[model samples]
Target chain A: MRHTINLFLMLAAFWLLNSGHYSVLMLSLGLGSIVLILFIAHRMDVVDHESQPVHLSTKLPSYFFWLLKELILANISVVKHIWLGNSSISPTLTTVKASQKTDVGKVIYANSITLTPGTIAVDLVGDKIMVHALLEENIQALETGEMNRRVCQVEN
Target chain B: MDVAIEIMSAICLLIGSFLCVSGGVGVLRFPDFYTRMHAVGVTDTLGAGMILIGLMLQSQDILVIAKLVMILLMTLFINPTASHALAKAAIHNGLKPVLDNKERNNTESESSSR
Candidate 1:
């Protein structure tokens, strides 16, 4: 019930924002579409905690900001290596142990790795994520386990 | 105040453009398939993000800004998933990443499990 309300509010906001006109006819049409979409969504059976993660709400902002910093720093390093020629790069593929227990947590960690410029999470098997890094230190950064810890915080 | 916003916006857009071009360069210059994926990832994440933020600063309409935020969020979530999929598929197809010489011998042995 809470998840449904969450989805409804999100859809309502999305529709209201996208459709600037608030005329009687336009609003009724928008409300109808929203109901129709909600019905389809309920039938699809994806309206669950994973879809509307209310628990992560408070923690997400800090994590997002930290990720943004990580992203910029990684970008700077990558830009430098890109100009420094192929020899400057040390392409390393290594599997890192994901401390995340939940599937959502594991996914967050893997996606965070890929979002950083120099590293890409190639494959996830069990709790291990196969990572491809453009530089050795980038993999070292992952091994340092700060990102993994933050993701775990988000999940728990 | 307005000028400051414009200045920041320009800076962001400029940096975004530079990152995007750098990504293109990295794509061409990098040795193999896997390293090149990182290059493209840079283009979409911070590059597109900065560009959207820059656009957001310039726009007055709340709706337009909201839409730009939506695009940025979608890109952030989608790009990594797509890249991960591409990387996994490539690996499954026996696309080995070019690694340092120290680990070259071990690479073949480890790939069999993935």
Candidate 2:
């Protein structure tokens, strides 16, 4: 039920932002389309906790800010390496253990790893994630499990 | 105030462009596929992010700002997903990553011991 409302609100907001039309006809059409889409979604049985993720609303902003900070730092590191040339880069591939219990949590962790500049999550097998890092420092960063712990926090 | 905003936007765009150029260089100069993906990731996350943020600052309309935010969100979500898919597909096709000496030595020792 909450998920349905959340989806409706999200769709409506998206429509309004894109349309920028507030005429009675346009408004009615937007509402009608939102309802139709909601109906289809409900029929498909995809409107659930994972689909909507309204529960994470409160935690997401902080997590995103942290991610942005990490991204900037990562960009600086990568930029430095790029200028220093290939000799400075020592690529490493290793498996990092993820502590997230749910699929969503695991995905968040994996995506977070890939989102960072120097590391990519190649595969997720059970709770272990195969990661490729451009530098040894990135592998060490993952070994610390800070991102994994933050994702677990997001999940709960 | 307008001038200040313009200056800030210019700075952001400059930095963004620099990042994009460096990412391109990294892609061309990097040894292999996975490393190239990392370079691309840097461009997708920080390069595009900074550019969008700069554009967002220049736009005064609330709708434009909202749309910019939406675009940023979409990029943040989709870029990683696409990278993951490509990386997974490459690995599935038996693509091997170029590893540093330390990792290679560790693997070699462990295999020899067994």
Expressed as tens digits, the lDDT of each residue in B51-92 for candidate 1 is 999999999999999999989999999999899899999999
Model 2, which residues run further than 4 Å from truth? B102-114
Q: In candidate 1, what are the lDDT values of residues A14-111, reduced to their tens digit?
A: 99988899999999999999999989999999989888887778899999999999999998899898888776788888899998888889988998
Q: Whole-model Cα lDDT per candidate?
A: 0.89, 0.89
DockQ of each: 0.50, 0.51
Tell me how much of the true interface, by contacts, candidate 2 captures. Answer: 0.85
Residue B100, candidate 2: alpha-carbon lDDT: 78
Model 1 stretches astray by more than 4 angstroms? B102-114
TM of chain B, each: 0.87, 0.87
RMSD of 1: 5.0
- lDDT of candidate 1? 0.89
